[model samples]
Target: MTDGTTQPKPPRPPRRKRVVLADSRAPVTVLRTVLELEEQTSWAEEVVRGFIRTQFWTAVKLALLVIGTLGALPLVFFLAPGLSGVTVVGVPLPWILLGIVPFPLLFGLAYWYNVLAERHERDFVDMVEK
Candidate 1:
């Protein structure tokens, strides 16, 4: 118990050597569907055509909705001539309705379109992957 000498430590185990099975410089093969898509095969073109059609219809619907909402404003003002006299914070009711209101409405519609578009793309990708 009174010895001043310290005991030597045990040897550690050897480290594992990394073994690579594949050559890093070799060209990797792409998936069949991915290759088809890139090469624009008939099947791939059809799938892409369907996606474009869906997007076109979506844009058309949104455009119609915007047209309907904005288009109705002028008709409403014309029908109710008394509305022209109305004002909010020194700005005419028509001015606020036409200028301020459309921004938020358009923004909301854009957000909706973006969500639907992303969903459609996601679905398309899933279908392709399968």
Candidate 2:
């Protein structure tokens, strides 16, 4: 026995609106705003890049400062006079290497390096900005 069934109808066609392409000749107002935003973004990016360079140079200088300090240790002791009890226990003042002098010297050097590094970068960026 065969059963006869009615077939379902097809879906309706889709509706569409007219398409528009971007016009090359934009209005003066829109173009002006775009230019303003672009300038703002350019300035911001320049600031960010300048900051990056400054920070990098600072790191490099700091590393060099540290290395220089460490390297000078031997020279400092070598140049010190033989023990004369000017320091306690007959230990020469120069013997006070890591315990005293080097620490402060390293710190001072670090501060100096950082300041100079920051200044140089600031000047460069300022120049570019102008």
Candidate 3:
């Protein structure tokens, strides 16, 4: 009466350290791996500080560019009043510059910021992962 089919083996216990809950019948859960920063890890701290400095400088540069451009509009208009009178298909140059031009310029700046931030993050990740 032996058909020769072998039975499956039982599951093995987990290898990692696990903490069982206070409940009488609760299952054991594996501990999550956490980053230890309190120890003497000056290299990691330096890398983080450098990354933050790079980000801070990047933001300051972009802000100066945007603010400088917008701030110069009044000076340009003041210096060259004729520019405000110029029209393109019945719309004044000032209207075009102030209303229509900024959207694309802002979007371009935002795109550049996203690219730069991603690059910074990628470099940071590579340094840490290595």
| Residue clash pairs of candidate 1 | none
Any residue pairs clashing in model 3, and if so which?
A: none
Best by TM-score: 1
Q: Which rank order by TM-score, best down to worst? A: 1, 3, 2
TM-score for every candidate vs. truth? 0.72, 0.42, 0.68
The C-alpha stretches of model 2 lying farther than 4 A from their native spots are 1-43, 72-89, 117-129
By lDDT, the candidates rank as: 1, 3, 2
Candidate RMSDs in order? 9.4, 14.1, 12.1
lDDT of 2 by residue, 1-130 (tens): 5479777899888988878553457666555545544586765566667777877877887888777877776675667545323575666665676567777887887788778877877776455434
What lDDT score goes with residue 67 in model 2?
A: 79
lDDT of each: 0.90, 0.68, 0.79
- Give Cα distance to truth, residue 110, candidate 1, Å: 1.1
Off by over 4 Å in 1: 1-30
TM-score of 2: 0.42
